[model samples]
Target: MSSPTRVYVSRLAGLPVYAPNGDQVGKVRDVVAMLRQGTQPPRVLGLVVEAFARRRIFVPMTRVTSVDIGHVITTGLVNVRRFEQRTTEVLVLAEMLDRTVTVVDSETTAVVFDMAMEQWRTRDWVLSKVAVREGAKRFRRRGQSHVLDWAEVSGFAQVEEGQGATHILAAFESMRPADLAAVLHDLSSKRRNEIAAALNDERLADVLEELPEDDQVEILAGLDTERAADVLEEMSPDDAADLIAELPTDTAERLLTLMEPDEAEDVRRLLTYEERTAGGLMTSEPVILPADATVADALANVRNAELSPALAAMIYVVRPPLETPTGRFIGAGHIQRLLREPPSELVSAVLDTDLDGLRPDDSLQAVAKYLATYNLVSAPVLDDEGRLIGAVTVDDVLDHLLPEDWREPDKPEEDHHAS
Candidate 1:
């Protein structure tokens, strides 16, 4: 027989699968690998086929007679049931691409952008090599490319069944939310949803807010209704409202009802605002307290790590009935002002009421000028009654200022270098 054909998983996917009699059987949907063997390289198990009737089934490697860049020929026998993986099996594209892994020989880390497979004999295929683009950030550098023998890659193949998500979470635990979202956007939809589902609500919310609007909607749509609502609640009201506005009316209404009442109310109020106004960009929750609150209270609020430095740099003071539609806006006090006073001193004593508070309908240009004129990162938004309503954060304003598609990466299509 001629030398066995070699191909990559990316090339194999979507190729038509044929039977021994020259009959078309199905198309390749994914390649499955058994990871029970030692970590150097896992055993190639089978092909997940999308056959007639739109059904998905598994054809064991033993039944695969030949595989080439253009086609796969099977033994004309395949199990027609839906492909359910045993604990030892993994779907290559779903679980592996964009995965951070280490090269054993060089001890360098890289992501698996594509994998090469070698057909050693009739019906015998094995993972042969990995094609990785070496760079810490995808957009920051057009990194060097390297092809390494499959044995040189260590981390991913060694992980046990059901551990892929765990490993992925640990790999990205230290990444900034924006960076994490960028990585997620580069992955296949299947891999993207898997990582998104594994993340906790707060972390997921932060990542969601950092993603572009379409990505934010896609991630939310992948989640179950209740879990999606919970994540929405974890997001700032303005962010949540922006996402909800992109969803269909019925889906948006259902998710809103599922959210906690107060959280839903905040998002609902934000949704009513025009997109370019202060009201549209401001967060309903800010570090606000009564004018009589002590300097110690302001310090405690600022010290909370969850608040962004911009929001934490100052505190808003209001009169009695300090709530959303709060009592009259008394003034704002910066953290520097708070620290100079005694812990027992009230915010009312040092508050600077001279600065102009933003109105909900203030133009984006007006809001920008206000922040620039005062050198403030966050400015309070007040109503006709002078009740404190929200705070426009600089980050939100920057989002508007940046070009559309600013969050998208500039890379060309993924590489297709098969062995």
Candidate 2:
């Protein structure tokens, strides 16, 4: 049979000291239980010592009733008072209606869970009652409340690693899944899905997109179509379309059917084109202006709508009846240069009637070349019928091509030589 579990405490039940290492050793007085920040259900372990002077002590492991780490906690009191209000003492959450108490479960001498300051604070602490739990409730509040059981807590509730892993499990066994997920970064496919599913939809969406491609597919596969659609809808249309484009046709169709009508249509349109083409890479969001508006009005629209700077180029002026998707867009113009012109000037007057066009069907390589050849800071993208779709910027174009490890060395020679 497996060996019985062993638990250790740094504070001794009867021994109490006022100073570290009991320099001003005192008897164990009343113990103080507090709910410190970052702790759940609060803890009761530190002690009040009344030797030469009264002080609080923390009970760190390895130095039971001893001043191991030189430190002491104390409330501002010149002299100890008879039954001083415990509230005035240095405590966070002291008296609680409900509390969990741990006993040795074996030796009567062992106090599994108690209230005592670290050794330094409890130095010369006053010892009494010797042993008493306010309530009989005690088992263990271990594991992340939101995520997996046996979760380790660190900076945040997440999977702890290296030396930290062992510490979190041994210390903060009772932690929230959210607190743990915040700290965990790299996780295996199974673990990632385990946690992603446990988190609320919003957090699940956030973490799911950050996961590796294979893991992304695996996790998404586990979620029902409706849930999958909701998450993909939150992601940028481009990223969403890319992921969906990679799925099997039936799977893609299933998810798309569950998506919002408008968003679904947008993704379906994006999916129509090859993944490497401009249409495939382009965002469906676009900025459209009427052919009659003045430069000032157009500027206000861009500013008010919060369109990004990269969209400043290729400001399209369409003929009247802009509400119609198939409405004709007259031409393109540089909004920056137009800003210098008189505000009264019609946008059509400043529009570049001679600007070249980029149809959504064009390949990404062609789009890259368009930006390079024209020295265009950004360019407008339109569908086959001339409906403005999105503006492709040099930055977005580069991001599509560049890898994060561009500066890192090449991979193994087998992969390099093949290139």
Q: Choose the strongest candidate by lDDT.
A: 1
Query: In model 1, which range of ten residues has the least summed lDDT?
Result: 410-419
> Backbone clashes in each candidate structure, one number apiece?
0, 50
All candidates: CA RMSD (Å) = 16.7, 17.7
Off by over 4 Å in 2: 1-185, 190-212, 294-297, 304-309, 312-314, 320-325, 341-345, 383-390, 403-419
In model 1, the runs with Cα more than 4 Å from the true position are 1-164, 412-419
lDDT of 2 by residue, 189-289 (tens): 44445445555565565555444455568878978788888988876566688788779999999999898888888788777777667777776665578
C-alpha lDDT score of every prediction, in listed order:
0.79, 0.50
User: Given candidate 1, what's the lDDT at residue 313?
Assistant: 80
Q: What is residue 291's positional error in candidate 1, in angstroms?
A: 1.5
Any residue pairs clashing in model 1, and if so which?
Answer: none
